[model samples]
Structures are given as structure tokens and as C-alpha cells.
Target: MDTTACTILLVDDEAANLDLLELVLRPRGYGRLVRVADAREAVAAFEAAAPDLVLLDLHMPHRDGLAVLAELQARVPEGDFLPVLVLTADATPAARERALAAGAHDFVTKPFDRLEVLLRARNLLRTRLLHRAQRDARGAAELAAVQGRLLADEW
Candidate 1:
């Protein structure tokens, strides 16, 4: 974990829970961390901080994790993918399904495992970066096709 370029935007309303997560991620080599206690501020914090990954807590006061996930999905462009890890003590199948449908890249059941958290975070970040790179390549190809079409018209 060369944590040099990684930042995690952690969204958890509970102070104690937030502290526990900080302990987990820090030792795992995630040095750049921004924590927002409210779900409402997650989007703004995400954009402002520009984190490479996010660890979202499922249960919150005003807006729940599912709601926040939906918002993030709405904001991301077609080619942009954000890695969202939903942390929940609840292990119900319905909860997992909803989180996945709302755009979370993975789920972390709480009473957290030190190793699994880091592994999932790293994997999801890789997925997001790859998706963005592929999108950039597609955009470049589209631009080249348009240029070729214009050149053909001139000829």
C-alpha cells in the first residue's frame, strides 16, 4: 500500500464509530483522510477534497447511506466511477442489495476486519481508476473518428 496518492472520504455520523474507522484506515496506510459527520455534506466534501475512495456508513441521521450513494451516482459522469464502501453492522440481504443498487462498489460488515477493509478499499480504487482510464481512451477514439470524418468531407 503505497498510500502516497490515496485519500478516503469517510462519512459516519457517530463520533465513536468515526474514531474507530480512523484507527483502522490510518494503520492500513491511508494517510489522507477527510471525515464528514453528516450525510448531507458528503457530496460537497467529496468534490472539495477529491478523495480517491470513500467509506460510507449506512445508517445516519438526515440522509442514510443508500441516499448518499444515490446522490454520488447521480453526480458522477458517464465515464467517471467512484469507489464507495458501505459500512454497516446490519448483515441483512435486503440492505446489501439496496447498497449495491445505489452504486456502492463494495460492502463492509462492521465489527470490522482490519485486513479485509484495506483489501476491499484498494481493489475498489483500482476499479474506479481503470474505469476512468478506459473512458478517457474511448473519448480520444471518438475525437479521432470525428476528425477523420471532417477530413473525408474536405477531400
Candidate 2:
């Protein structure tokens, strides 16, 4: 998938953080960006956007990142893959472990380095593209098999 065509959803309560991310990503050829200030809006935005990647902030009011992650996991179909990258100020080992266990594909600490964020986001998007291609191939193969069986029965 083209980086410029890929849609990314940014979930953070802080307007500044969301703005900063948009600033960095827009010039880097990421044209489709969705920003959500509240964690509660994350899932809705995700469903609406069908983003290729998600940048999630761990600390948010009403619903925390973990809760949002769970909702995202539930929303995604079993065979589909959605890459969720957790961004947080918490650098503790426990926090990292919890995020990973909760289905985060990657983690970035607060005050994130611009280059690192771009690189990680690129990698995750690449993975998403690959996953989608594989799923599509599997679906095509299944359809072909069913068609072949039908043709054999007719013969």
C-alpha cells in the first residue's frame, strides 16, 4: 500500500500531541490522518476511518488506553489485522508488558523522537498491508476451490 494513501488514526486527549503528530506525518507523505481527543471516540473514529494504523495514547479520561485497545480488538474481525501502537509517558516495565499483552503491536514513550515515530509507523503500516494481502489471497483461494468443486460436481 502507498504510504500517502494509508489512513492513520491518532488517539490522544491532548490537542497539542495530536497536532504535533499531524504536523510530522503530513509532510512525510501521510495524507489521510484522523485525530480523536477522547478515548471514547477512538473506536468510533476507527470504525469510520478503517485506518491502516492506530497511534494510541495510553493515558486518557473516561476510558483508558487498555479499554480502548480491548474495544478495538473486539471490533476487528478475527481474520483481519489492525496494528495498534501505544504511546505513553509511562516507561515502566509493567506498563510495556501490559500494553503488549493487551494487543499493542508497538510502544513509544512520551516525548517521542520524530524519526523513530515515523519509522515505527511506517513499519506497522507495511505489516498491515502484508496482512491484508495475505487475507485477500486466502479468500481468493477459497473461492476458487468452491468454484472448482462445483464444476467437478456438474461434470
Candidate 3:
């Protein structure tokens, strides 16, 4: 998948954070960006956009990032992958472990390094695309095998 064409959902309560993220990502060729200030809107936005990646803030009103992550995890099929990168000011080891255990593919501390964020996002997107490609290939191979068996039986 082309990074430029990939849709990314940014879920943060702070407008400034959303703006900053958009500023950093747009220049890096991430054009399809969706921003939501309320964590409550996240699941709806995600369902509507079907984004290739998600940048989720750990703390938000109404529903926390962990709750949102759980919702997303339940929504996604078992075989499908949705890379959730959790962003938070909490730099504690416990916070990081919790986020990872809650289904976050990656975590970024507050005051994130612009370069690191971009690199991580890019890497996650690449992984998602690779997984999709592998699944498609396996599906095709299975279909081919079935067709071969049917042809042999007919002969």
C-alpha cells in the first residue's frame, strides 16, 4: 500500500496535538488524515474511515484510549491487523506495558520526537501492508489448489 494513499486516524483530545501531528505527517506524504478530538468518536470515525493506521491518545474524556483499543480489537477480525500507536505523556514502564498488553502495536511518549513518530508510523503501515499481501497470496494459492484438484477429478 502506498503510504501517501493510506488513511490514518488521529484520536487526541487536544487540538494542538492533532494539528501538530497533521503538520508533521502531511509533509511526510500522509495525506489521508482524519482527526477526532473526542475518544467517544474514535470507534465511529474508525468504522467510517477504515484507516490503515491509528494514532490513539492514552488519556481522553468520556472514554480512555485503552477502552477505544479494546473496541477496535473486538471489531477487527482475528486474522486482520490494525496497528494502534498509543501516544501519552505517561512515560512510566507500567504505562508502556499496559498499552502493549491492551493491543497497541507501538507506544510514543509525550513530546514525541517528530522523526521517531514518522518512522514508527511508516514501519507499522509497512507491516500492515505486508500482512495483507501475505494473506492475499495464501488465499490465491488455496484457490489454485482447489481448482487443480477439480480439474484432475474431471479428467
Candidate 4:
């Protein structure tokens, strides 16, 4: 997979965190990154970018990450996969549970290891892209079957 082809939305209320994320991802050839500092703007950014993966902060002003997750859940089409990785300072089990329940695919605490974050992001993106490929293949196969049936009917 082309790392550059995958667009990642980096959402954090803190500028430093966003910069750190960019620093971490850019070196790995993830060139298409959309950074959103305000939690309130995350949904709009998500809509505009259609990112393959999201790095979200749990606590933010205006709207919390859970709210953003809920909005994203509603916006995402059923049966489609959009990976959300929660990155926050909250390490409590309850926080993790809440985030997972709210549609986050993975959670990492703040002061996270660079390698761990990178690996998690890579894994999520891999699964998401593979799911997309499988979906597309199924659609193509279904179209072909319909075309075949139409041809048979004509004959």
C-alpha cells in the first residue's frame, strides 16, 4: 500500500500534539494529513477529507471526543469501516471502555511510545484499506452477475 495514498485526520485540541503527530507520521511517508486543532471542527474536517483513519483526542473544548465519535458514527455508512484511534491522557479503564463503545477502534494513552503509536496507526489503516478493497470487489462481482443475467435473458 502506498503510505502517501492514505489520508489521516489528526484531531487534537493542542497544537503541540498535532505537531508531534505530524512529525511522527510525516517521516513515515504519510503525506496526506489533515490536522484539526479544535474538536468542534473535527466533523467538518472529516467530511471534507474523507480520511482513512482518525487520531482523536478524548478531551477537548466545545465538544468532547465522544460527541465527535457519535457524529462520525451517524455519518459513516453502514457496513463500512472507518478506523478511529483515540489518543488521550486518560488511561483509566472506564475511559477506554467509553471510547471503544463510542466507536474508537483503538486507544492509546498520552505520553505514548512513538513506535507503538505508529504500529497501531499502520495496523488500523491496513485493515481499513483491506476492508475497502473487499467491499469494492464484492460490488464488482455483483455487477458482473447482474450483467450476465441480463445477457442470458436477452438471448
Candidate 5:
């Protein structure tokens, strides 16, 4: 899969954080990025963008990150590999636990290392792409079997 073609949804209340995330990803050939400052608009943006990955902020005004994560969980179909990387300054164990339980694929605390962020995002994207490929292959195989059965019955 071409990672550069993947769409990424950036969900952060702070403009600076959004800018920073764009800065980090733009140079890496990540072309399609959708930035959403309000948590309220996240689901809408997500639905519109259909992003392969989401970089989410834990603390927001209208809705907390965990709540947003829950909403996302409900929206995204089961078995779909849409990775959500929780980015927050709250490095507490409890926060990490909550995010993970809420369906975050990876957690990164704020003031995050640039290199680490890139690596983590890359890894998650890789997994997502692989999952999509496998699902597609499975679907193709199922379709082939159905077609084969139909031809056998016709004969």
C-alpha cells in the first residue's frame, strides 16, 4: 500500500498542536490530512474523510478524548483497522489505561519526541494497510468460490 495516499484525521482542540502534527507529517509525504479542532466535529470529519489513521487529543472542551474514542468505536465497523493514536500531556497510568480500553491503538504523551511519533504513526499505518489488504484478499476469494459454484451448477 502507498502510505502517502492514506488520509489522516487530526483531532485536536489546539491550533498549535494541529499545526505541529501537520508539520511532522507533511514532509513525510502524507498528503491528505483533515484537521478538526472541535471534538464535536470529529465524527463528522471522520465520516467525511474516511481516514486511515487518527491522531487524537485526550483533553478537549466539549467532549473528552475517551468520549470521542467511544463515539469512534461506535461509528467504525468491527474488524476495520483504523488506528487512533492518543496524544495528550496527561501521562498518568490511569489515562493510558482508559485510552487503551477505549480503543486507542497507540498512546503518545505530549511534548512527544518527533522521531518516536513518526515511527509509531508509521507502524500503525503499516498494520492498517496490511489489514485492508488481507480483508480484500478474503473478499476476493469468497467471490471466486461463489462464482465457481455458480458455473458448476450451470454445467
Candidate 6:
């Protein structure tokens, strides 16, 4: 697999939240972090960067994380398979279910353990990278099949 270092996107409306995320993730060799202060911009960033992991905050101005997650799921198949780790203060079972239903891979409540968050982030990134490799391989195989068919027709 020709996989490179994973890229992570941290989405929240709070500057302090971004600061904390960068502080925690930077030392762990997480050098490819894309931080956005608005939840609304997540989709564009997701499309443009195709991050290996997304750390989505539950609440925000304009569009919340849940809303963004919904949009994301609609756009892609098996959308929740992308390793979405939601960060929020909502500990309610209903909220968690909503997240899970909306395609979140895991939930990390606010005031969470720093070490635990780091571990989760690393684990999710690994999963995403592997998934990406698989997807790329499948795409290449499909393209080769189509090209072979075209060449056979030409002959």
C-alpha cells in the first residue's frame, strides 16, 4: 500500500478547542491537521482534503456537527465507515445513538481524557488509512478491467 501520513481535520467553532486539539495532536507526530472554526465548512474541507480522520464537535454556530455528519453520509456510500470520532458534551444515550445512526464511528465526550483521546485518534487514523488503501486498490483494479475491455475491442 502506498499510503502516506494521515491527515486529520478538527472542526469546531471555538478557538480554544482548536488550540487544545493542536496542542494534544501535534506532539504525537500528527503534523497534518486541518483546523476550521466553523462547522459549516466541514464538507468543503472534507472534499478538498479527504482527511484520514475527522474530529467533529457536536455543537457549533451555523451548522452543527451532527448536521454536517448527516450531509456527509448523504454524499458518500457507507459514509460512516470513514472513522468519524465525535467530540461533544452530550452524553445522553439518545444523542449517542443519533451520532451512531448518523454514521459516527465513535464518540468522545467533552472533558474527555487527553491520553484516551489521543489513543482513539491514532486508532481511527490507522483504520481510515487502511480503508483508503483498499478503496484505491479496488478503483485501480476496476479501471484496469475497463481498459482491458477497451483494448480487446480495439483489436
Best by TM-score: 3
Tens digits of lDDT, candidate 2, 32-62: 9999999988999999999989999998999
lDDT of candidate 1 over 1-155, digit per residue (tens): 25436778999998887888788778766778899999999999988988778899999999999888888778776657778999998899999898888778798888889789878888887776777678889999999999999999999
Q: Against the unseen true structure, what C-alpha lDDT does each candidate score?
A: 0.84, 0.93, 0.94, 0.93, 0.92, 0.84
- Per-residue lDDT of 1-155 in model 4, one digit per residue for the tens? 65467999999999999999999999999999999999888999999999999999999999999999899878999889999999999999999999998889999999999999999999999999899999999999999999999999999
| Candidate number that wins on lDDT, 3 or 6 | 3
- RMSD in Å for all candidates: 2.4, 1.1, 0.9, 0.9, 1.0, 3.1
Error (Å) of candidate 3 at residue 7 is: 0.7
Candidate 5 regions off by >4 Å? none
Taking all chains together, each candidate's TM-score versus the true structure is 0.84, 0.95, 0.98, 0.97, 0.96, 0.81
For model 2, the run of ten residues with the poorest summed lDDT? 1-10
Q: Rank the candidates by TM-score, best first.
A: 3, 4, 5, 2, 1, 6
Kindly report which residue pairs in candidate 3 clash with one another. none
lDDT score, residue 81, model 4? 98
Residue-level lDDT tens digits of model 3 in 55-152 = 99998999999999999888998799999999899899999999999889999999999999999999999999999999999999999999999999
Q: Write the per-residue lDDT of candidate 6 for residues 60-120, one digit (tens) a residue.
A: 8899888998876676666335778998888888888999888899998988888988988
How far out, in Å, is residue 17 in model 3? 0.4
Candidate 6: clashing pairs of residues: none
In order, how many clashes per candidate? 0, 0, 0, 0, 0, 0
Q: Which of candidates 1 and 4 reaches a greater TM-score?
A: 4
TM-score of 4: 0.97
